[model samples]
Target: MSRAIEVILRDEIFTELEIEYPDDRNTNLLEQGMDSAGFLKLVVLMESKFNIAVPDEDLLFENFSTAGLIIHYLTEKTMS
Candidate 1:
């Protein structure tokens, strides 16, 4: 799932943003050039791709701050 998320993120968000960065899970997405709009789009895309709804309370920076975090968040949400 993490690899799939990474590929989608690279193709959809990072590539669109023209960002160049390693595929490090701990890499900070915001630091890598993802902006507010990109983040929103990512959230929407994740919800759609994973078939999971991210609750309002879970919409925190800590949850989506990095690629790994987003994958982790989705794993938890979907598994629950």
Candidate 2:
């Protein structure tokens, strides 16, 4: 799921920024280059691709900080 999310982020969200996917899954994307707009794009893409609605409460930075966190959040949501 993380791999797929990486592909979507690279191909769709980060394409305009020309930002490469980091080698470290734990890397903070915002620190690297991602802006608020890019972060929102990622959230929207995740919703569309995963068919999951991210609640307002889950909009915290921690949940969207890294690839692994995003995958884990979605996995937890689906499991619930």
Q: How high is the CA lDDT of each candidate model? A: 0.73, 0.72
Backbone collisions counted per model: 0, 0
Q: Residue 3 lDDT in model 2? A: 62
TM-score of 1: 0.73
lDDT of 2 by residue, 1-80 (tens): 55665576557655655566667879887876877877777778777766789889888777778766766777776567
Lowest-lDDT window of 10 residues in candidate 2?
9-18
Question: Per-residue alpha-carbon lDDT of model 1 for 1-80, expressed as tens digits?
Answer: 66676676667655655666456889897778777887777778778767888788887777788878877776677677
Best by lDDT: 1
State each model's C-alpha RMSD to the native.
2.4, 2.6
Residue 78 lDDT, candidate 2, scale 0-100: 59
RMSD in angstroms between candidate 2 and the native structure over all alpha carbons: 2.6
